[model samples]
Target chain A: MQALFGQLLVGLINGSFYALLSLGLAIIFGLLNVVNFAHGAQYMMGAFAAWMAATYLGVGYFWALLLVPAAMGLVGVAVERLLLRRLYGLDNLYGLLLTFGLTLIAEGLFHQAYGNSGSTYPVPAALRGGVNLGFMYLPLYRAWVVVVSVVVCAASWFVIERTKLGAYLRAGTENPRLLQAFGVNVPLMFTLTYGFGVALAAFAGVMAAPVYQVTPLMGSSVIMVVFAVVVIGGMGSIAGSIFTGIGIGLVEGLTRYLYPEASSVVVFVVMALVLLVRPAGLFGRQR
Target chain B: MSRIPRVACCLAALLAAPTLAADKVSDGVVKIGVLTDMTGYYSDLAGPGSVLAARMAIEDFGGKVLGKPVQLVSADHQLKADVASNTARKWFDQEQVDVIADLVSSSTAGAVMPVAAEKKRITLLSGPGTTAFTGEKCTAYNVHWTYNNWALANGTGREVVRQGGDTWYFVTADYIFGRSLEEDTTKVVKAAGGKVLGFARHPSPGTTDFSSYLLQAQSSGAKIVGLANAGADTVNCIKQANEFGVTPKQSLAGLLVFITDVHSLGLDTAKGMYLTTAFYWDMNDETRKWSERFFAKHKKMPTMVQAGVYSSVMHYLKAVQAAGTDDADAVMAKMKATPVNDFFAKNARIGPDGLLRHDMYLARVKAPGASKKPWDYYEIVKTIPAAEAFPTVEQQACPLAKSASPAVMKK
Candidate 1:
């Protein structure tokens, strides 16, 4: 049905955000064994950065597309160096609590500066409208978001699974203490891996800015859902996050079509069910 | 934090001492506190702008009432009722705030109204929409100003139904505000010979996606999809509805909307949508002048909430001056007896049930091309007078309505 296809398209778009955010989370967890709860706030700041660029500097969305991630990665470097690096060897809960605290601080600063009235970042002139595909009408901006997020997810997957750096990263994940003993500079790796993860979050935020209202709470609204996506995909698996993110997004889209009111809760229900069966996530390996 | 700034502050106060002393204000200082959502969803609608408008009213009144200095204090309620109650308690007890104004959310209004009633302090609500605050939840010394759900539904509902668009589907946010909006609009719609197809309830304050809800509304085949939501929820729903192309087939009626929302959603998507509002900055020369002053300070046009705060604060101070006392009962009686004439409202009066029955405008969003300038968003479709816009005497079951009798109301 046309409705089904349309929702599927929507699901894919939402999946793109989930895939990108969770992929970042998974990458950080894989390298540092710390659940970076501030991923959503980082993504939100990326959008704000894009908005600031456009509003103050006359930088367009495309330029923002390239500039925001690299800029937020720098922020990530500072965050990891000054704060996150302190809790490197502590219990994972400390990182979670620390990042969660950081998220509150980041979101709180924006909230204080810009009230909850959402500001719209206008869709770029080039991707302002949509085209009718064979089955459904697809907006150019949304399509661009899906394509770019998938491409990034795939490229990250390839780099992590295939490259020597990825091999070093994976081996570092396996035995960071030994890797540091063998002159791998594991601490710097931890910082870069954390930076790279948060950069991915910022990348998603830039993509999301034009679509959703760029409010401080925008990240919090969907952060829980994305965390569910990461959990359901197996915590640290790269490809697992991508597939499960897209898959859950589609399921979420379908639920919207069938039971509209449950759309927000459907992903959590799926996560609960998946946890009951798999114990890990759908793509996660058993410990 | 420094002695220099402290000295500067004291010097500024000292400079104002001559004006305060010479103004012949009663020797007692009357302190007014503004409690609102400064950091939450309704922040921009009535937050700091409303506070600024209140100060403007005080300045226009020579910043002195009843031969005393009129002081202002404000705190963020964070959109929580408990926070509102605690804040109101602090203002009323510790700070000696005589009146609290510009409470934004119904949850906070509802929470703080009782506290104000217990304290016998005047509470003026400028931003909340639920009339339940005036109906079953009515309390003494509390006035619902600017607008409420009944007025919004009555204004938008009657027009949409009269235009031969009868069948309705509602996408209501799930909350006290949204529920009351739905209830009020349903009454108006059925009264106008319209029938409801069905409705859906989206989670309040958190819903970002509305495609599924819009799709459901689309499938209902209703002529109109009424949005019983406010703030960001309404903006998101309307924007998504535009993307979903539901507008050409089904007219989307924003039951409660703010000028801030219109500014956020460019005229392109918001064009042709019907909304009812109590004030627009460009509605008249007086409004334009007052709003220009407001815009100078805030760098934005005043919303109805901000305008209402100015008008209500002006009315409260004048009542206090007339009664020659800061006593809540005396000032409230004077406020009720006096008719309001301001940039916000002309000949508006507080009814027996403590609802300020001001005229509401049913305005249609102007097309992007038809708009000549920024913030020129609305084309007034109809002006529903106070009598027609608000509920009748018999319709209001407010306990206070029984004793006072709305004979004070003018047709």
Candidate 2:
């Protein structure tokens, strides 16, 4: 039972990364009609940004937590305005390919700069150890990650679902020309939405630095799984991506508990099952 | 650099090296391509660091061999076997790269050695650990430099079993390299009269979360947990093991570890762990000198793989100088005839099977306070003799070594 509870905690922590990353992907895909393939690279960059802060500038985790995302958001906006904005009228596949190319270039540059064995970002002093829950040791940092992830995910969903800004954003997504006639700057909305989505990815990467080693490939490693989560949840549904991400994370943890060998592929297996059961996804709108 | 005229150099090299097409490169130059994982998991151990070591070797060797300027180049294999095989092909076919050095991961090395042999070019592997390199996959133009699975398993696994932490459970990265590591270490455990409890194989190379895997290993009651992975995989496993409180009870046998891994993992999590390695930067004055140069460039102390690159490239250049020819077979013959005593390996010998015999160290990670300074990680507990560290020639039964003496052949 102790072992089981421990696995559950692991599941929740793993779920947080999946949920956060998928949420960002869902938002960008919904608004831009372009799959942000560089989400993973942006995530990895976030960690590297934090690592650079701590290593060179003596910036600690708290400052990195607040500052790294904002910095990466600027990077995100630059990418959108300079490159992605040009590809807006092309096929969505072109956007995927371009972002994918950007991912490769970014990852390659990072690899040259910081060879891939990765460095440790020490868990901040405040969240150092864990709580003995009588059944198992519950790591304080992991619990914090889960709590913070839920709050961020909820905040993102609430803003997108209930705010007037969200209404303009949604209207722009539906028909940019129509939204523009209402004096809305649809292009600015697209740019900010893309930046906001990228910031979320950076936030997740910052959170993951201490949990997972900060390797350039960390984003590529998890991005595939996040895509699987998005596909299973529905490509454009905010709640769907969030819920599915955590659910898959738990299922993976359970698989690890039940059979360690199957843990890696269990998420994909669940994806296949979901695809078979609901071709449109659990929350996807009927095409 | 080369005193010879361009046209004359092409005809001369082409006559002596028929394997390379005459039109490849006309200049009297020896191009050595350092193929390694430049952008992936194994990069830290052998990427730019390995390239720097190769360059240092060439520079130290007077930058010329047989009146030909030595040119060094490199490419990132990205940890893909197909990518490595293609790069090796292109280097051999078009680039006129005479020798390739530092094939890091076993998969990349395995994919490349056959290509090198087929092309009649020499390859020096500085980081691969699969025993198949010295046995089934042995090639006339290939040398498994520094260490392999046999050395790591015996050096670390035997020491762990000897310490009475015998019963073993393996948390392996599921793949060719990881499987081979676990299999080799398992043999060492059983040979030491230790019991093999069970194992849990995790995702290969890319796995980040290891908590569930650690929980299973912790609950299994194994006295010692063997980590059959390298680079980032190994570092993450050890770190997560500490977080789950698994390390306090059962010792971890780091089946494959490098000094850089300890630097990333930090001594707090890696302390007291037993590992086997070919070189540690602080091993001696010679090692320290070379490592300092590497550190100046890489901003971190060298891993054994990087050190191995220096020694192997140095030796390869020496063999070329001795033979007075860049012919693959001739250089290989001179290499086999020579003995290696360098900053990394002490009196190391290349076997007929293409495996190099060198002293392997049994070391324990230093506690936080015990460490003298940054990168001072290991306390060498024992030096496993070269003879016992690698598999015997007879046991390997490499076709190339079938006629050679079973004993260590010293020049």
Q: Which number leads on TM-score?
A: 2
Residue A51, model 1: Cα distance from true site in angstroms:
3.1
lDDT, candidate 2, B1-411, per-residue tens: 465687788888778785463323235788899999877788777788899999999999999877779999999897889999999999989888889999998889999999999999988989889898889779888999978988899998988888898899999988888899999999989999999898989887789888888877888889998999888888988887777677778778889998878887878878888889898888888988888988897898988898899899999988888877787877888898888988888777888889899998999999999988888899999989999999987788688787655453444
Residues B196-245 of candidate 1: C-alpha lDDT, one tens digit per residue: 99898888777787776776787778999999999999888887777666
Question: Highest DockQ: which candidate?
Answer: 2
Stretches off by above 4 angstroms in model 2 are A1-9, A56-60, A132-136, A272-279, B1-28, B405-411
lDDT of each: 0.87, 0.87
| TM-score of the second chain in candidate 2 | 0.92
Per-residue lDDT value at A84 in model 2: 96
Candidate 2 has which clashing residue pairs, if any? none
lDDT of 2 at A220: 97
Candidate 1 C-alpha error for residue B95, in Å: 3.4
Q: In order, what DockQ does each candidate have?
A: 0.42, 0.62
**Residue lDDT tens for model 1, A1-287:** 76777777788888888999999999999888898889889999999999989988999999999899999999999999999888977999999999999989988899777767767888899986777675555668888988998899989999999998999899997888888888888888888998899899999999988878888988888889888988999899888889988998899889867887787889989999999999988888786
